[model samples]
Target chain A: MTGDEACAEGALAAGCKFFGGYPITPATEIAEHIAKRLPQVGGVFIQMEDEIAAMASVLGASWAGVKSMTATSGPGFSLMLENIGLGICTETPCVVVNVQRAGPSTGLPTLGAQSDMMQARWGSHGHYEIIALSPSSPQEIFYQTITAFNLSEMYRLPVLIMTDEIIGHMSERVVIPEASEIQLFNRIKPEEKSMPYWPYIPGADGVSPMAVAGEGYRFHITGLTHDEKGYPVMSAEAHVHMVERITEKIKRNISHIIDTEGYYLEDAEIVVVSYGVSSRTSLSAVYEARSMGIKAGLLRLKTVWPFPEAILRTLASRVKGFVTVEINLGQIHLEVQRCVGGNVPTFFVGHAGGTIIPPEHVLSVLKDAF
Target chain B: MSIQSDQSDQQTHPLDDLLRKDRIPHIWCPGCGIGTAFSACLYAIKSSKLDLDHVSMVSGIGCSGRGAGYINLDSFHTTHGRAIPFATGLKLANPDLTVVVFSGDGDLFAIGGNHFIHAARRNMDLTVICVNNLNYGMTGGQVAATTPHLAKTTTTPAGNPETPFNLPLLAYASGATYVARWTILHTRDLTESIGEAIQKKGFSFIEVLAPCPVNYGRRNKLKPLDVLRIYQEKSIIKHFASPSELHLDLEKGITLGKFVDQDKPTWLDMYYKTTRKKS
Candidate 1:
């Protein structure tokens, strides 16, 4: 199966009962596959009028007590930013898949790039934390999408699956476990015995238990800075409290959320850091450098946001230097440099992004870092 | 005749249970008509006799968009101009829930016009109530899509050059199963119409003409009473009137009543019938 189809299958495995989407390149197959499969499982698949409506519908479905998602590329992702912010403020849980293609605007719709990594972190126009995962292949994307949904439900915020055109279109064998074997997480519902539910009071985890529409909860929710009762509060103090709780929830859960895989790091001197498709290239280069006795290793990032900074900071003390390889011009590289805090030099091998970064380029960077 | 009968100490308001009294006093101006129109909507919900536990309301940003926040049900105040699509998702996900999109004219037509027409065309099961005050009331009466030609607004100080949309005609053309128009002064009729629409299936729309006296009326040289007087003197109730003929003309005559009420399969009905057949 292709990565897009695997993404849909993963959503189904995660108990996503609703999908609202509009067609965009590199991501449309996720919608197409789910549209055909949802009906069989008593789920809903709505092709909304546009990307904006698609995102709004997803949020609404989530509040209706259904796990929902949507898929889009650069242009559609831009249209979805406002409502994504709404989801964040209201603390609605859903998934957004951005099968990234090359673009400042319509640059290359059919081609692959890691250019949207920064946008996924800071796209939605606010001071809040988000969870994003990048997968290198079809099998990885399938697993990562399910993980994305679980994190979204656990944190009560939207989670992003940031796969690029290459990963989305590539075909590979995806291992699907039995439904009973796949772990699933659901949003915490308010206790029915609790009369007059206050919908925004955080528990010990800094996540408020959600109350869905109907079931006589009669709770109110809005995109405004709201009180514990979900009533709008326009004061600056209210805004501070609301923003802090949402941001702190993710910040405190960093050890549980950030995922990275280390390769050939035993007594290595040169460390190459990459994610998504670029990580595949970096792995190949690491193998080639080790064959040549260059003592190079790979640090593959599976979860991009929250950036695995602590691990990188620890590695800085042991490694000689770092090489950050990506398809875009030094996005994650800036984070890599910041994490080392100028203790060690960091080199970047990338471009404005139309084609993939070749292994040879990473090998040359690895040789240079040596 | 009976001051004790109206005493707050002796009797509670019938709609108090449905209201969030702590959030009030509301932000509407002294003469603004949203209160009356909103009250009629609340009464309609009461008279519809549907399960209140299964009812939910959604609103976009505007003066009337505050309806969802004020209601004591499962309500959502969503982003500006996206209430219809949001409500569509809610209804589709949980067919048992009765979803209503209550918002203002500018929110329903200008920024949100595409969502409204598409929802109507698809015959999505929803009750959409639009309060048309002829301008963006919450934003200090900027010019709106429903603003009359040659009328004054902050954005249209030189007079509006664009002609207003005949909202009933638009709703009817967009394939709404039930379409109606009423003024805030016709509280009983509006309430009855809303109640009927809520009980009926498919996409139902009710456009309520109301006054934005502080922002719009002052700029247009009409007081709140003047607008009500025009609604009283010039409005004609003609059931099953052609929606195209129903336009707002204060100097001439304004047409009001139920324009279109037909039977059609809602989106969910077709979705189930077709998908079950395929599977």
Candidate 2:
């Protein structure tokens, strides 16, 4: 199966009943596949006007008590930021897949880039924690789409699957397990009926049970700084309480949310940190470094935001030097440096939009570090 | 008579009480028609007979977009110009619910113009109430797509250099099943039109010509009452007008009334039928 097909199947397995999006390059295949598949499974597929409307439609579908998703590229991702912020504020559970393409402004719609890593975190204005996953292969995208839906439902936040054009368009054999083999997470619903249910009240797990519209539970939700009752109360205290709760819900649950793959970290002198398509290249570099008898290891980040900072710190302490590989010009390297805390020397191997960092470049960085 | 008696007997209308009281010192200076237009919307919602719990009001960023947050339903204060698509998804997922989109001239017809046309073209089961204030009131009175020709606004200090759009005509052409235009002065008629639009099954667009007292009103040297008087005198019902006659004159403002009434299979109806047949 192709990566796009894998993503669509993953959404179906996760019980996504609604898919609304406008087709853009690299990501168009996801929308096309879902459009064909959704109706067969008693679901809906709506082709909206633009990326802005596409994102808004997904949010609406989610509120109607269905798992909803949309797919897009860099330009479409830029258009979706406003409504993505609304999803965060409203605590609507939905999945957004950015099959990233090269761009400052439509630089290369057909080519691949990992330029949206930072944007996925900060694109939506205001302070909030976002969950973003990076998949290295078609199989990973399929599995990660399920994880994205689970995380979105559990945390009541928008989950982003950030795939570059290369991975999104790549064809590979993917094994989709039977429905009985896959685990699905549904939104926690309130048990008591006609009771005053506060949509923003978090339980012990830092997740609030969701109540859909027409469920007969009266609840208010606002974009402004809101209290537990979901009513907007503008004050320093309310702002502090609301912002802290929103951020802390994800922050406190980092242990359960963060996922990373570490290779050859024991007694390593140098480490290579990368994610998404870059991880594949970085893995190749690690293999080359090992053959050259270099004490080098690799850390592949699966979950990008709520970034694997603590694990990076532990790896940084064990290694003498670190190298960051990415398809963009030194974006995640800053985060690597912040985590390393100047204790170890860090090097960057990066390419701008429409270019991919070769494995040799990463190997050269490992050699230079040694 | 059933609708009339229901309208009269209802005391403490839930929809009316849900509106913002502080803004009740409304920004529209006295005589501006927006208040009358807004009241019509409230009346229409009250008469829809749909469960408030099953209704979701969505608005884009504008003076009118603020209407979503002020309403008592499950409201969404979304981004600027994206209400149509948002409402589209909401209605598709839960066809039983009533979805209403409220947006201003600039927000709906300008930035959100693509969404508006496509939503109409798809014939989605949603109610879209576009309040044409002639200018972008929230952004300090810039000329909008619905601004009349030679109209004085902040952006068009002398006169609007570009041609304006006839929103109901555009919507009617785009395949909206029910399309209507009414000025704020025609309160009872506008309310009745809104009620009928709400009762209609497919995509319904009601373009209300609301007055902006602080912006367009002051610039045109017209009070809200003068704006209402202009609408009352110049406007003609679409059914009453000749097909060859243009709705608007450059000197005198355009006529307003229900322009299109057709039956088309809505997006939701088609979606369900297709899914059910497959099952």
Candidate 3:
């Protein structure tokens, strides 16, 4: 299966009942696959007018007590930013798959890039936290897509599955697990006897047990800075309390959300940190450098946002220096430097972005960083 | 407008039960006509044969956007100009849901105009209640897509230069199965129109000419009641009027009545039929 095909399958396995998307390159296959399959499973698939409406529809269905998702590339993802903020503010649980293609503005549609890494973190206009995953292969995208939905539901955050054209188009064997093996979860629901349930009021776990429409739990949801009762409350105090709850939920649960894979980090003199397709190249470079008797290791990030600060901080103290490889000019490199906190040098190895950084280039950066 | 009063006083209306009494004394200016439009919607819902639990209200940002927040239903207050698509999702997901998109002129026709035409074009099953106050009311009487030509507005202090949309004509042209126009003064007619639109199968549009006293009225030199009086004297009930005849003429008269009433296959029905036949 291709990465995009695996992503749709993953969503179906995760019990996503609604797929609302606009067709864009590298990401269109995800929508197409789901559109054909959703009807068979008693789910809905709608090709919305535009990406903005697609994003809005996803949030609407999620609030209507169903797991929903949407897929887009750069321009489409850009249009989705406003409603992504809406999803965050309203705490709507859904997945947004940005199968990234090259762009400043349709720069290269049929090619791969990691240009949207920073946008995923801060594209929406507000102070907030986001959860994003990077998949290096078709098989991994399948797993990460499911993980994205699970985390979105668990944290009440809109999780992003960030893949690029190379991975999204690459075909490979993806093992499908039995239905019983997959863990499925809906949002925590308020008990029947809990009359007058304040929908926005989170429990001790900092997640509100949601109630869907037409369930007789007549509740209000808004995109404004709202009070616990979901009423629009415009004040600094309300703003502080509301923003804190959203940001802190992910901050406190960092242990569960962050996923990373380290390749031979023990006693390494130089480390190459990367994610998505770049990680595969970085791993190859690390092996090539090892064959040449260099003490180099590779760190692959599965979860990009919430940046694995503690692990990077610890690795920075031990390693001599770091080399970061990505398709963009420098997106995740900045995060790595921030997490490293100037303990050691962090060298960037990247392309302006229509193609991937080669292993040889990553090797040179690894050698030069030391 | 549903107040949290004693049981005896509340017994006068069924709308009280379908209202969030705590959020009463809403932000609309006193004598603003959104209250009347909202009342008409509630009465329509009450009088309609649809199940109350199966109805959901979706609204976008504006004065009228507060409709979802106050209504005692599964309400969603979405972002600006997006109520139609949001409600579209709800209807498609649960075809059993009677999804209503309630919003304002700027929200429905300007930033969200594409959604309106497209939803109508698809013949999506939705009841769209657009409160047209001739300008962006909550934003302090700025010019909008529905602002009448030569109308006074904050953004158009010298008078609006852009041609405003003829809402009924636009809805009719966009293939809305049922299209109607009404004013707050025509409560009986508006209520009956809303009830009928709610029962219509495919895309239904009801445009309410509301009075935004603080924002729109102050600029146009008309008080809230002046607009109501204008509706009584200057409006002509022209049911089955041609789409071209529904244009607003502040002095001459605005056509008031259902302009289009017809049936067509909805987006979902075609989708299922085509996909099912292929499969």
Candidate that would win on lDDT: 1
**Candidate 1 residue spans exceeding 4 A from truth:** B1-11
lDDT values of the candidates?
A: 0.92, 0.84, 0.90
Question: Which candidate number would show the highest DockQ if scored against the true structure?
Answer: 1
lDDT of 2 by residue, B70-157 (tens): 6656777677888888888888898888888877888898999999999899899888998888888877788989777888998889
Per-residue lDDT tens digits for candidate 1, residues B119-222, read 99999999999999999988888999999999999999999999999998999999999999999998899999999889889999999999999999999999
Q: Which candidate do you rate higher for DockQ, 1 or 3? A: 1
Clash counts for the predictions, in order: 0, 2, 0
lDDT digits (tens) for residues B1-279 of candidate 3: 786767674454568878887888778889899989998999998889778888999999999998998888889999999999888888887788899888998999999999999999999999999998988888778999988888899999999999989998899899999999999999899999999999999999999999999998899899988888889888999999998877577767989999899989999998888777853
Give the candidate order by descending lDDT: 1, 3, 2
Error of 1 at B235 (Å): 0.6
lDDT of 2 at A297: 89
* Tens-digit per-residue lDDT, A126-188, candidate 1: 799999999999999889989999999999999999999999999999999998988989999
Better of 2 and 3 by TM-score: 3
Residues A1-370, model 2: lDDT tens digits: 7788899999999999999989899899999999989988889998887888999999888888999999999999999999899899888999999999888988899999999999999999998899999999999999999999999999999999998888888899999899999988898987776376778888888788888866766355667677787766779999888878878889999989999998998867898899999999899989999999998888899999989899988887778988999989888899999999999899999888686678998998888775
Candidate 3 per-residue C-alpha lDDT over A273-329 given as tens digits, one digit per residue, 9 for 90 to 100: 999999998999999999988999988999999889898989988888888889989
Error of 1 at B51 (Å): 0.9
Give per-residue lDDT, candidate 3, residue A309: 86
TM-score of chain A of each: 0.98, 0.98, 0.98
